[model samples]
Target: MARSETESERLKRIAILNARLPRTRAIAQGVLRDPKGRVLLCELSYKREWDLPGGVVDPGESPATCVEREIFEELGLSVTVGRLLAVNWLPPWRGWDDALLYLFDLGVHHAGELDPALYLRREIAGAHWRSIADAAAHVAPYTARMLEVAADAEHPLYLENSEPGRTR
Candidate 1:
């Protein structure tokens, strides 16, 4: 029979097991819209396509918390996260590994209230309010699908590779 383990030993074992498990990266993004239903998209310096405002979730940080933090960090705007919008599974692409992306609502604001010039982050070239159809031409194909699905979805969605999935 095996001897009982101390708390420290148990914790060490758990840590080892945790590290051995598969790690799927998590990304958090927020959908900000205006009364006209135009979505706010950020022009990224690193990428050609404009994208929603958010970033990778840090260790021990919740997705909601991560979006709020990323918004302020990248856009210099303090925002409260709203309801969850969608959960999309991304397959390995563009030299990056697979990741799960959480989309959250950031509520609506008057178009005049948001000024892209004020977002001084180096990574952000600009931000713009674009209609869904118009945004598709400026964003990635997957992002466009995500926007279309999320906008039309009546409830929270679960997507696989940016498309509607069997699981909700």
Candidate 2:
């Protein structure tokens, strides 16, 4: 004779299995350029380096949708997220767990549309438009590498630690 599983036991088993799975964090960032060919970067209040406009991806949200949502929430700019440019796997850093960063194209707009005075979120200290070379100097090293490739990529790429040819 076989014993039937109780609801309590089934719930405990599911909880245990879920806890054992990999739980890497996910981030969605957008690359919005101005007519002058400068990428829009955010000066985050908490970090020294300026970064592309975006935020962490909430659970169950698609990366494309996450980028669109993040751009509006963080900068108060409603943007239509374009094709995914790259999927970069980031290693753990500065006490945060490993994460996958999805980079999407936010399309170009006139520079005047992102005035600092219009900022809606306190997390953003300001917004800057920088050329690829200039942005590389101010953003994180990983971000710099990602920009180097993703900026000119005609198709999507998979990067590891923001470096090409390392995807696994």
What's the TM-score of every candidate structure? 0.91, 0.89
The lDDT for every candidate, in the order shown, is 0.89, 0.88
The weakest ten consecutive residues by lDDT in model 1 span 112-121
lDDT by residue for model 1 (32-85), tens: 998988899999999899999899999999999999998887887889998888
Name the top TM-score candidate.
1
Write one digit per residue (lDDT tens) for candidate 2, span 1-168: 999889999999989988998899999998899988989999998889999998898989988888888778777788998889999999999999999999998899887676566675568988889999998889999999999999779999999998885534
By TM-score, how accurate is candidate 1? 0.91
As a whole number from 0 to 100, the lDDT of residue 69 in candidate 1 is 91
> For model 2, which pairs clash?
none
Task: Count the clashes in each prediction.
Answer: 0, 0
| Model 1, residue pairs in steric clash | none
The total of clashing pairs for model 1 equals: 0
Estimate candidate 2's RMSD in Å: 2.4
